[model samples]
Target chain A: MNRIAAFSIGAASGVVGTYLTLKEREDLKVEPKVFKYGRPDSPVSFHSYSAHSLAYDRARKIPLWVIERLSPHDIKKEITADRHRSNFQPDPFVSPHYSSANTDYFNSGWSRGHMAAAGNYKHDQKCMDDTFYLTNILPQDLDNNIDYWYRLENYCRQLVKKGYSLTVISGPLFLPEERDGKKIISHQVIGDNNVSVPTHLFKILLAEREDEEPPLLGSFIIPNKPVSDCPLRTFQVPLETIEKHSGSHFLQNLQRNKALDLCDKDGCKTISLNELTLYRYAQKLEQATSKEALEKLWAEMESKAIKLDKHITAIYKKKMNEF
Target chain B: MNRIAAFSIGAASGVVGTYLTLKEREDLKVEPKVFKYGRPDSPVSFHSYSAHSLAYDRARKIPLWVIERLSPHDIKKEITADRHRSNFQPDPFVSPHYSSANTDYFNSGWSRGHMAAAGNYKHDQKCMDDTFYLTNILPQDLDNNIDYWYRLENYCRQLVKKGYSLTVISGPLFLPEERDGKKIISHQVIGDNNVSVPTHLFKILLAEREDEEPPLLGSFIIPNKPVSDCPLRTFQVPLETIEKHSGSHFLQNLQRNKALDLCDKDGCKTISLNELTLYRYAQKLEQATSKEALEKLWAEMESKAIKLDKHITAIYKKKMNEF
Candidate 1:
């Protein structure tokens, strides 16, 4: 039997002593970040420089969980996009270290998806580059990466904009895929490095209100496929579903008995930038002097907004209502 | 000058003492609901038979506001439609009241819109019929009554289904309309009863969680026009906007420093029952044994879901994601 033991998660605040432990598999070594809360007599991490902590699984070469404390201030920074591929450096912090090479993605159809998006940590150049660490990269479909997943990332940012300070945990799921009536733990591998390609990726956003009310939780689980066609809400699952699949618990200490009602299972219709931009343009068209021009613009926007997919249309309907 | 003084809102629990008063408009008598909270030290009115309370404006023969406590259970009870033109009975509760006759609506090119919809109080037959009172009725556009306004009503019910206990305040808005740089409260009066025909109607839905968090507020202001061409979200306004126009406050006692983040100002694409039903049917067809049949069904559902209004399509996208 594998040993299943709890290790105290160290933090400057003694109150935040919750643990993230394994169920039964001890083969993969687990290490929680030693959180250094700043200032004396503060019951919480009030002024800590670091906004995130990670527990990596050296065996999988991916993080077990990348927990981040995101605020509006963090996302407010403007950072230049690092479009040029940077060097994949191994963190000296991990013992028995293995560096993931950029060559591992050579000729592979998958895009190097960021588990913790670079856009999120644009607060500082160093923090932005820290997201480039090989462990944060997961094999993702290009369409899913830039489109479907991007919508969720935008929503998280929007939540922050709405004055919510979120504690987000993102990870990959290598659940057993059923084949011919049998559960099989099979997945694709890339390069000689044997970097495991996850079957699914998930993110759990725990949105905490400033008023000390129970947190609003939103969990998204999407297959490692082209998800641009689907709505963001479609990937929404109950928090319990994520826990059941990953064998991991999140915010268990802070959540206590609070209910997670943020799934919005009925879902939201997420819109593309083009669509949103078009809608904003349409709003401007409402003030057109020429009746002909206004009608023409209305007709064009109407067709696009009306002919959209149900989910997108739903989002469109919402936008239309705002008008 | 009209006296606008706050009145004591009575209930067993002192917490239910939130007042609803008017601002110098004593011409229309205002009497806020005196909520009767049940035993067990409940801060709110729970386990009470009545779903709502109203403050009717006797002079206008319309309600100043109709506030209702809505839940899934309140909407679950089956009540036969009150068709065949029910009599417009006068609410005896109001002082120095005069009964509004059905003849007032005769030859009027408008439908009698229920401020608090009849469908909402379907829990009991008497309660449902109570909505037919003349004070609850307003001169509404036929298209707006049956379509645009109906969509907002359906959404309120859906929110209740999602575990929200909503306090809904529906009223008529007689805001000053501008004509050649002139602000005028120009409105039509129908029949001898002098029933004021409002240019627009508004509803404020404050969804309170069971856990006692600050309520989520959604304010909608729909024009009394052919709103069938308009989406439900197009009418969404801020809570502050409603207060500024009406000169009435809401949730003042319950909400302290907490920000009202419930308004999806950009808007959510809320769905219609027909759209939702069709989407569910589409999901079932995915497992069809016959490939040709499955393809045919998919094509049909796809076109329907895709071609829906932006709001419905957004909902459709969420449903599609699940599959």
Candidate 2:
């Protein structure tokens, strides 16, 4: 890029113009006409992180959207982050007043839920901890965060396990409801900082198709309240619906009809906690089989033989092989 | 800038990366670390215009904020754009469903208020017309839009007339209000598209200081409803208040105590409509004075002389010269 010596015509000396050093922007993206006199400095900032990237909505004290890329290998890694160690903390990068604090969610009957879903970033401890930052948080209903939202996250990982590169975009929504012949957008704001409690939360799952041209684009908008045993498919919505309300576009090349439906391609059903409990129980049962018990007995016998002497251990090994 | 052959790591092949063709982004602003597997694509889209620039909130269906630049010379231009000819229209750059339309405002009771007020872009017709696009609009209270909001805009122009170059950052605010025991953020949504009627509107005025280290930064948050003739200064707030609520920092160098207050520096009082009406009336009265009456009499005499004869007109001019 050649050095374009021209300056913006409009006198836009707002704080956002200096977000990056002028010298940094001196190279490009400086449209002479737009910033003819000054930069088109809007009151918004973009921040990128390891596990996820987000556009924080400073006004709402919530992220506009939290974006994350997930792969089966990353999700299925044996060594994952420990949730107990990571603490919910205010984002240091965000100004104190704009960044949400634990106090905001304290005694407010709400939970600070991760939009980037900490469980999804399990490949590394730091990557998982990154999702704990309030910048990636949303004021969510307690029961809903634990039950339905938790299950939905698993559903995302399940898709990855099925072998598609998944992009998860999640955020809060202040949906308008009809009242007195007029639609009203209303939600609770918690704490001294007044973090908004969104009326609804949306998650868009964009998965790359194996054979199709455009990726599978699926979006869902669910209420913040708990849904008792309701199918996840009930929340399914057109990707455009989320885009229009969120004021963002997903993929330009995406085609709805021809593109594989995420739900149809891979069932929208979530594995129940009861089933997971039983599966763990069955694994324990499987480990206690006669062959496993015999192996354990042989190991104990070998240890006893070692206690006796090296000659005894050699004799014990021969006996174990014969068995 | 070298051709960074690296693609993003966490797969973020969302639409935003393709916003300005992938080729354009091949050089810079594409941080390999952030988009290590894919792009760190957030749904938010930034659109720059001749009169203003804005970050459209895809979820909220409103601009996160509107930025504009103003100067005294531009405001005082002899020939300005005619507002009557400009029509309010949907922003073509925005998708149909996401973009606000005229039908969205039809019979909604709320008025489509311009964030970058049309009056401020009077220098060029096209610039003034650009403000009419819905991308620069917010659904606002009609009375407030016409009276108090209108005055605030004129106040901006008047500030320009005072010689300081001004930057106005304006947007809707759904501030939390204490109700019953908890704080609630509530606002009306109008029409089929559910366009949000912001509970409050804010204007942050950033004026260049002649000698001060940083610019004067002042902001105000006024309700969407009429103020019942209250002084505009009553709504004066610290710049941080707006930034904190909006979630975007204005200027990094701005120190509230050291930097001048825009309201204090310019005198927060707005020129009221009554005062404006009286001033216009006074101007009309000033035009019809005694000197003007004497000139009118001579002109009538000259016309009468012409009716009589050309020689008589010369005599009348000579006689009138003595008077």
Candidate 3:
């Protein structure tokens, strides 16, 4: 038994020894890097809505500094439209009948609705109208949007009674074009129950108060309906689309101008020159470019559009023909 | 004003019309598939440890259907091994240490060390140790590993008593690597904090359990010290050495396998097969592959041979080197 033991020990050591010897002659290596998890610099972008839709894209663009600077009055302003436009269009870019104006007509029969009731903007119409931005909107059930949404609004009101005010945004999650090919729509769901809503109707909410509550917000809702067939009404445009439309790649540009700043603030590792160039071009488009150059840029953007119109038409035609 | 309203309506319709026309032209496309979150097909592995320096790993490569039909005791026996023999290696593999093995050690030290205390063997020990098959070990603090780790162990034990035996895996947390750009280690931390450990140290007890309560079978201790300069211990093998010892393109093989897995899982969304393959190959070389692999897999697996040798070397080096 002892001899067997010796042999086993020798064999084990020998195997290790052989490995070590080979490693010494050549080299064996292992490299592992540490990764940190926190809030991602960029959240996943949604693509069922339009680039011009305020509900889908508003909160992301609002700089943290800007949000910090905002006062109750500023929040109030977002809920209401500007006094100059009394008879404003529900949605500026698409017609009411096209499904963009009201998302209730789509397959999901849901719309991006605000938990922080748009009606709350009665105190300031400008703020309420600004809430119309695609970013604030979320896919929501019409009944739930009007009812439970109102309940949430009431909850916010109760908070205000206890000396709290909120600047909230909510929307439905939309499946990106990438996901559509799989025949499954990527909708947003909250909590363990997986309460889901149409991908187009996703929303985010941001609320703050003067008291000592640890930021009473961070939630999303998914309504259970298609709501409309019009792409703009039913989907939130992808961030890439907005970048293309604005002619400015925000992440790339931000990194270039402030490499160190980006690292310290956002934990970004590096920035590429392509991003810098895009940023510069965006600046030119915003302030320095000629109309012709801007037109050319828009034309370029047009080519890259994901073309939701085709998807809607195909589905509509199929449905009509089937009926 | 009415004309503007009409124009707005017309503009909206035109936008919808254009979208429909674009859809008819097959411009918008849906993605082909959606990604699922959990692994549905992978087999479970188990790990076990004794009061002494014995650890065992056992996993069957048999299909899941066959394995699931076996009795728990039969499954346990299939993976068990006597720890005293040098060649008593367990197939699959087990973590070399028990959660409580180093608790006494930590109590004497300044810092507390933490480890994955539960959710190992498909939430079973046997499963966890099989997972320990060289691929899962990371450099960790002894104090934290033992002290906090013991606490976590106790918590899991309590949960098991309460009929909550489900195992959960958490933290692919990224920790900083050595100053040299060699490797990064991902650490997994487990166990909930609802249960507390009894301590007879300097601090006084705040509460006591009622006599009717079940004796607290599991309790943990926190380490005295929390941080250190070189918190993690490396196996100390160079990358080049592994390739030479294994006589195989070890790193390349690992990378290829990992890349394939990633492609299958993530839909080729983030990492390419080529990149993953390259990364894996690099990792095999960094850890002294031949010696470590042989020691872990074949010899000293069920016995103290490797550890005794290590102890002898430490003593001899201390005396001889000093002389």
Please report the candidate that would top lDDT against the real structure: 2
Docking outcome class, model 2:
incorrect
| Candidate 2 lDDT by residue in tens digits, A1-323 | 12232222111111111222223334335553324324433333455566677767656778877777787667678766788888988765555655678988889999988999888866787878878888789889888887788889988888888887887888887788878877888889888888888899999887874655566767899899987777788999987677667655454434456667778866788877554433333334344445556456546545644233344445445444554
**TM-score for all predictions?**
0.36, 0.72, 0.22
Q: Fnat of candidate 2, please?
A: 0.29
Each candidate's lDDT (Cα)? 0.54, 0.67, 0.26
Residue-wise lDDT of candidate 2 within B244-280, one digit each (tens)?
6766555443445666767676687887665543443
Off by over 4 Å in 2: A1-49, A121-123, A161-165, A207-217, A252-257, A273-323, B1-43, B121-123, B207-217, B251-257, B276-323
Q: Candidate 1: how many backbone clashes?
A: 20
User: What does each candidate score in C-alpha RMSD?
Assistant: 31.5, 13.7, 27.4
Q: Model 3, residue A57: displacement in angstroms? A: 6.9
Query: Which wins on TM-score, candidate 2 or candidate 3?
Result: 2
Candidate 1 lDDT over residue span A168-264, tens digit each: 7787875554455433344565554445567788898777666756677678888877765556767878765664444344554554357445655
Q: Tens digit of lDDT per residue, candidate 3, span B101-145? A: 222223332222123322223323443433232212222355544
Q: Given the true complex, what DockQ would model 3 score?
A: 0.03
Clashes of each: 20, 29, 134
DockQ comparison, 2 vs 3, better candidate: 2
Model 3 reaches what TM-score against the true structure? 0.22
Candidate 3 per-residue lDDT over residues A163-260, each given as its tens digit:
44443333333233323222222333322111233333322223345544333332233334423222121223333332211211122211122222
- Each prediction's fraction of true contacts recovered: 0.00, 0.29, 0.03
